[model samples]
Target: MEDSEIDHVMSEIHLGCPPATIGPFLSHFTFSSYPLLDSSNDQSMTISVDKDGDLLLPRRRRRTSPTSHSHGSFTVTIQHSITSTLPDVGLQVWKSELVLSDFVLHNMSLLNGLVCLELGAGTGLLGILLARVAKAVFLTDHGDQILGNCLRNMELNSSLFHPQAIVNVRDLNWMSEWPVEVTHADPKPFCWSLQDFEQVKSASFIFAADVIYSDDLTIALFSMLKRVMSLGCDKVLYLGLEKRYNFSLDDLNVVANGYACFRRYIKEDALCDHSDKKSSFVGKRIDLKQIPQYTKGYERGEDVELWEIRYLIEGCPSNTILIKIQIKRPTNIFVESISKAYQALTDPGFQMGIALPQFLLDIDGASGGILLLWIVGVCILLPLVITVIYLSRSSKYTGNYVMHQTLSAYYYLTKPSLAPSKVMDVFTKAAEYMEIPVRRTDDEPLQKLFISVRCELSLDPKNVKQEQAKFWKQHPAIVKTELLIQAQLTRESAALSPALQGDFRRVLELAPRLLEELLKMAVLPRTAQGHGWLRPAVGVVELSQWLIRVVNCRLFPLVQGSLLESEGISPFLQLAHFSDAVVKKIARKKVKSFQELQEMSLEDRSELLAQVAGLSATAVEDIEKVLEMMPSLTIDITCETEGEEGIQEGDIVTLQAWVTLKRPNGLIGALPHAPYFPFYKEEKLLDSACGCSVEQRVVLSWTKVEP
Candidate 1:
């Protein structure tokens, strides 16, 4: 059988119309293209397989004759076997592997002298071929058993790979923190280290086959891929997949829905574009053309979907939008009606029913009057009762559904003398004084709101007028800047303590307004005391740099999956435990977030860390440890109020304290460089003159107290 015959058979199988010229599909493709004439029923027969899934049949050597792309034909020996019900699926070669292998054979020019990494390299088919032309090839997959099989297969084809070209097999689990292990080989050029994360990160091209199957794996795989792609490498990804349409028990016969999920994942990855039921994947920098049928004689070649992903490094039109949208529910008229009816009925002057005279019921000639009275009573009472019932049935709590409009914007205060713990205490006491049920949220954005004090505040006096003008233009609807001056209490400035009380009061007054302006500017909500306080201009120049770090940390996974997840240069501005100055230094070197830093090799990361201006080696190690130990989940804070009782709304002032010792995300002990031990607690009643770091983020609201 020739490649044309295999292609014809595949087309027939895909049509599901009739059995094509009966032939062995797997055996013919696996072996030489010799027709194995068999009944169509024999196609479903299973071959005997060993525990390791190696074919039990006798081994035979097979070779593919060379084309213009190859110096010589490639050969391999294999034993036919059936895949077992094992967790390790890499023991078998799927159709996508054959398609990718064929793709490599024809495109030898792309691999020559480049470092390649094959993800999910089942049976080492594609890796073996890439090893011929590539300078080095790293074949990676999960599970020790699967890795063992890969090593065995690679060893079996030792003659096929170039002598100078290095072929390494390693274990790569997408969700684990375990370092990948490089298989030891004799005559190796250099000793492999567990810190060779750079090798994978710096690969010229990445190849993957049939990896996206489940939703969980899909999310994890893409997250891993995005992290890998961000490492300033040759951003080229070649993925081969046989569109698998899994059918539900209810709709087993529907083929359209079977491949629906697969198609959706592909589309979400920006691999294909769909319009008017016809799709085109060609883009300015990305192309995902299907390997045309007859590209190779793989079994079911027509079913394979080959995609080429070329990521534009400088700037690609991203489909990812990091903005989180919040929806508001429509007001309920039924509930309003019931509330009005209840209020009307409960009034002291309300009557129970129609004010009818006793004579109206007794008089036979007055039956018309009685009937009229009854109709009036029915009309008034029936609808109210029905309305009450409907309201009771439909009534649901709306308080928990916090609308976006209701959320108070974050206030950023630079070089504040108050502590975040102290600020939270003040707010908690204020809420208590007002009798509002206020609680600190584990919301990530809210955490970031408070945790951003560590970053630098870039303020510029030269462009203050211009930036403010641009800000007003950009945020015409946001709060006016004049409110900052109007809201200030300059008359009593002489009475307040200059060091803490004055600064605290000023921050409290300016925070909300600052938040409004920053949000309008579409930047992180941070601000300084004065226009010239931060040294550099507080415009997009400094804000964008900070935002890039935030985006890299929080939204990288989403952006990798779909460029549509966000638009423009928007970043999440995620808060980190480390100080802002250190993060800024790291960001300057393109090390945006701790996650990215953790992904780097120890030596490379250590060298980078040493370059930071003020950081010592010990401090760098501590920071690294802190980054490693930081929990993925949000930490909780405990608020402790004085007296444990509610104060009058008009009270002059109240004392409160906040403490948080619990470190979530499996972190043990106190965080590195933290001032406190096991816990951090601060009281609002602390003297204004008390020593506190200027880096603390303290929020104070005194004028707002009604008393």
Candidate 2:
């Protein structure tokens, strides 16, 4: 079937448009092509329409291979009479039949009267169509053969080009720098510089299609686009990319990353305006009409939505919003999450080692924290301690070996088992309790011992549970008792012969694993049962386990003087202070206030409770009823007076003062301000009180007036 016939069928099927006939009248339609015309010679040629109404040219008797042509420039001839036509190119015919051609053509045609450059202008059909309306078109390709073929194609239908249209075909390898100008035979100068062209001088818009399919090429294309756009382009450049499913997720990620990285750099440099200014390309408000529809061949089914992103070139430079893309797939969520996480981690303002707020770090931080703790612990223990100590003590000392093994296990398991800094704090506190100088070598034995203990505890859950129960029964303070035992064992082991020291060190190393196993066994049942109190219990047990590990790992080594003299335990000590502060804060704010009851009018009390509640609950049933009964009642209060008030208590005084209500411990419920006292004034004292005592005091008691 003819290209026109196929297009008619597709248009009918997809667009609900009536089919149009591809009759003999269409044969006279000549698609424009630019021939390599010789400027030195003027020749007249006859042209005629074929029987099918297509433009016909003379055909060549014999065909010359494209490779046989001279490398500089050449032309070809057709020998067929002006009345007979040849078949259309297979690919062009196929593309013309596609339903998406209408969409692509519509968007491309909108760049009318603009100086546009098309990269990788295969066959130059789209570029040629663009030149029909564009002020000027520069069509480029990396292959000379392709350029030649495109020039011929353009020449064949030159009548359709605008009278002022200037089409210049050139070879442009994207990886290389573009040259300033190229000389042509038409006596008109063609220069890539903005200074040479009025349209280019004002603004140079770039249009690309099907460009981001490969990693290296996509990078090169975008890199070139950035360079070109930065070179005096008055407005932000427009990029129209056709999505291709052949591209892998990895490739898309690379492109997305590169775009984000460049955008960030531009923001930091204060180049692109990320706030206030509207995009010149897409305009300020992105209504549904502004978003382009996906062209056919880009996707298979019904029209897929195309996303439009716009950025203004002036205003606040740091803010960039993703404007109009709808997330439809599950992987889209994951990709978005990863992109956000990558940005947060790489952002310069983001702090490492500290736990950021939940909103800032997101849920990924929980996983990141685990990995970071393990890495930091490994750094502190392995190479820093074991390697250094082994080299220094070259006599194969058995006592030192045993001590190192025990401490190493303790350090490893404990630090890895808790929050990074919290584990460090436990070690510092243990060192203080043991009165030992914290040293690097001391860290090794504890780390080793912790690791050994962790391994053993994991192997026997029942045994560890029994041990935990026994310890709890014998000593109510299990953690403290265990620490004391660990300290005593370390001291005795250090006092023994080298072999005995090794044996004791080995046993001490098992402490962390045993404690962890016991804590796990105790907490597992509660966790499985979904008990409400399980959280606090688990937290306490974990803290206890960590404390034991720290004692065995750090404190024992410090007591034995395994560390060097220069290193101070300040970092560990600071961590302890932080942990204490966290614990205190948690304890203070754990529940609402607890205070003795005081009688008051329900109406006044409801207002006070309303202030505290602040939209949490609408009303309490009994309190509402009580408030209705005691609408006005005398309430005891203390207040601070500001400004002038000239009257004594017994002088029938009338004065204004701000009233403040106090809670327990004399803490003010709120602040002294307006609305609470729009007409707050001291009225004349009422002596009509039946038998009520009227006492007033400057200090704690009220002063009394005898009736």
Candidate 3:
């Protein structure tokens, strides 16, 4: 079929428009473009992206120091959404893109008068900058929304480019075949002509920013790169990637998975023998310090790395190898090789149409009798081994472990002769108190990580509720105040022996001093102890809930998930003062929030407390008293949806959500959310939150609005 004819016969499928709720906004990046070309060079450049709301980018609070020099500059605006699901995250520009922009703008001469292509041009902010010096630029990406936004940006910063600069927004689907067969039936824009296709083939450089994130996408990107670069060995790809570390289950450690995949495909090693030179792909990491940061906004974290990649035609032509290495272990030998031989032959991969030699088939045929016996042995012994493991672990109960460990450590810090060393000793024993081994091997660092994470206390306004946000910011001694409060609260519940009472009381008297060590160690945020990047991801309640979840799901079927389900766990910090175990039992049940936990129709609170292990009568009563003081709120919601013309796709509609909260008996007034003064729309949503005492509120009072 003629290519032009295919364009006419087939239609292009672009992703449908995203919801209007998450519509386009603008984000501006202002920076100094160095080395002025002429008097016309703009020293102050502002690049705007489509991501503006009440909040700005990461370095919004930071301003550039005044510079005396004038240089080249431009203001670029991009149309983008602030957030999207992982797969469609291309709709938003990322931190790594800004870092890459600074690198490119700083080294402008390197790209002088060259033609280049961008793999994932996303909004094309970088390409718009490239168009300034490049002869021709291909702003390519997949998906309709991404391309549409990229084109919009191109139109926005048209003045930034020279009159002769040629920039094209085109389709580059990584998963699809390259040299896109655009037929006459295809109605999509940016269909390439034979000449344009040749220009892309001859383009000297390929630019990509923050494109390495997902494993599948990384694989597809390299696949496309191999095909494209194979056509021309002179081609070099500039990849500005941010290594995002995550805990990998397989590796049992934190790793940059996307970056690891990229490394595998490039096959580049820091130290290698002559055999490495025969590898088809070569990669080199560029020193970031060598490139001055031209853009001002986000911090260029250490995780950001830039690589210069090239494909070679000089390597072994076939680049394919099959391997079978000998394997043996001292612990166990498969003397039953007769039965084990079938294990490999029955694999799914072996089921493929791969042919086997006659000798291998003869060996497998000889193992039939032994294989039958092996299966029988596994069926009988597997059950017994599981039964023994389950019986031993389930019956074991580590009672009041958290209390014994934490208090025991504090026993030393509260002494009259307490020294600086004593303070450090307490923290060093933190993991031991938490029941984590003091001498753990390299593989068991995950539990220690959880302890540090659980200890995090975010005082950031964005993370905390509006009322509590101001309190933490205004207080000069936030750490001291918080630590003192925690100590005071816990001291009341902690039943101490007479011998331990004096030292423990001293701890309460000097509570604020405790937080100083944590702050000094950088374990907690410095001045902005309450405020941070986002709402806190961990707390005592979260830690408690996590443990309960793990304990509830034992390997062997037990008396866990079989129990009654919980309505929800209230996000209250006061409950943590009672210890994580106390909160675990509360979260395990309860038809309501913290306030309603006392509303159970039991004869007394002790009746319910009895179900929880490690609680005395006095402690049970104390918990009940705390629950009574908490704020109570029950919610009822009604939604009304209707249209005179009937609701249809693409039609404007109103979504009205009527929310009402059932408050506790003594409250009087229409405003159920009067807890905070000068009520705003955002604060109005707090009407549904469980109210806490003033002290408890600052610790934690999370609210969610269903409407």
Candidate 4:
């Protein structure tokens, strides 16, 4: 190389075009083919050395032989060389190729007996690996020099490939324009020969790694992809790339334009948009999925993402090929189940039949009598047989048939200790036998079935509480069942019997989950409101009273002085008699719980009560009576000769007092200027109600005596 050329390359590198862009220029000097000189002016710069003290040449060869117990053993040797002094960088192995080679070697089953083509083959490391299992392999690159390099590598690893494999190297420059392949076509522009085009048309899989680095390269790559996809063969592309992010001077930040460009290309070409920026196309169109994380010997970094790309034909959908394979096999569970059911139904003994003595025939002999009896028996059963067959086919009797089958399934399912999943499957199969709406509604056996399933799901007595709580919150089936049960209870024609409502009330009292569910149900509108099983529960006054009783029983403390048990300090105002307007007015004052009500001062209480709707001083008196009945704990301490009640100044002492409540004790005061958040205000209110939080507190007074 001349001095001017070296200086110019350094200038380009300093201009910040990326070191990779100057790789080719640097290779011109570092290549081993450069003539050695004794003169210091012509000395070859020794960039690095190997363990043996030999120069680590710019052009290198890697010999890799991966042996698996399942696949036996195979060795692949790849040779990389610069055929020109002009510094073509395509002759070296890249990190992507190493990762891809590792992947192909580990997952050899994906390539067995398949026709594969490697785009941008470079040193042909990945193609050589594929050739070991593929029926036919094509290693492709742009110019003759790179193609020759690929051909040489294939020869070096020829022994590693299967005996029947045909590994060929071809020139494929994606930027060139080529004709669409058709039958009996004449030669056109671009460098693809007849044989090369035929090979591409027959390929079933395409592999490329680290090919997309810039917009212009991405455009060329996708153009070739579209052309190859039009070949009318079932093919998929496994593309591996370490996504390239470039620092954009305009944005002053690194951006992943490689991935962005590909996504844009997919949006423009493969999918149809309806101006809403949402995908209009449904399943099995242009399918693309990132391959799951896999490990091999190579460094597959987190940034290296592999994708499987497929172009679905207009008429055929993705996975249909596998379905066709399954059809050809014709041996699966669905068919086996149907056959068994058919055999059971068609067995001769199961069919309607009768046998009897011939004496009833009144013939000359006993045989004649036996014949007459048989005739009579057949005559009697013939109508029954006809009736059964006719009913089975009648649409009007479908519900009856479904019911019978369902009952039978339930009996059989409950007979054995089956797993919950298995029980659900049996019920699902039985439901399939019956005619069902495409979507479920809050009616019929569907609602009943859903409820039964939910009940069965909660049958684990150990986890019943947990299951019920979870189901009430998350399961739609439980929601529908609750609504339906409520409807059955409050329906006008079949009003709930006293005994049934009592049973429900007892259950709600025992189960906090039921109380919460009832509370949720009480707020729903008492009419069908949506297109689902969203009809409101029986939100009648009776049910509301039951819920209120449960809430009160759970929250209130017992009475202190009277024979009547403490009705427990009501956390909130007992508003069973209050009108909805008054309840809302009190609730708006942030006095929802009894503990919160206690935090208000006498004046605050009076001012708050004055705002209640339709409430007079009599109502305030009633509220004060309830408040006085509420229990509270107090602590009193006395120290003689000291102004302080609890302790004397400078006296060493250890004092123990039982606190009735424990609550949040974090910072409660406001900032200098900022408004207090609702959360902090809530904390303050809770902390002030400490007495209600404590379970118990006791006071003991005793006089000290000499021991």
Predicted model with the maximum lDDT: 3
Candidates sorted on TM-score, descending: 3, 4, 1, 2
Residues 52-144, model 2: lDDT tens digits:
999975432222233343222122221111111122121122222122223334455566677777666645655556666777877766654
Candidates' lDDT values, in order?
Answer: 0.46, 0.38, 0.54, 0.49
> What's the TM for model 2?
0.26
How far off is residue 586 in model 1, in Å? 77
Candidates ranked, most accurate by lDDT first: 3, 4, 1, 2
- Would you give me the overall lDDT of model 4? 0.49
lDDT of 3: 0.54
Name the regions of candidate 4 deviating beyond 4 angstroms.
1-74, 81-87, 179-195, 267-297, 313-707
TM-score for every candidate vs. truth?
0.32, 0.26, 0.37, 0.33
Name the candidate, 3 or 4, with the larger lDDT value: 3
lDDT of 1 at 46: 63
lDDT, candidate 1, equals 0.46
Stretches of candidate 3 exceeding 4 Å from the true structure: 1-21, 35-72, 250-252, 269-279, 316-707
Residues 456-493, model 4: lDDT tens digits: 34246788778666655644433443433333322211
Clashes of each: 16, 53, 29, 16
Overall local distance difference test of candidate 2: 0.38
Please provide, for model 1 over 1-707, each residue's C-alpha lDDT reduced to its tens digit, 9 standing for 90 to 100: 47444321122212322244242112222322222222343457668889998887532222334332221223553221233223555665677766676667657787898889888886777787788788889888877667767787777778778778988887677885434346566533323465466676668888998776555666666656666766656457787766555565666663533244434434344443332233222222222243322223345534566776644333332322111111132255557778999999899997677566687768888679667777777887788899999776445312433222222321232223333222221221111112221223322422232223212112145786674455334221121112211122111223323332333343343333333333332222234422222222222222222221222222123323222233211221222234445555666666643346556887887787777635677876765664454333222333222222234454334333333322223543433322211122222211111111122223332233356
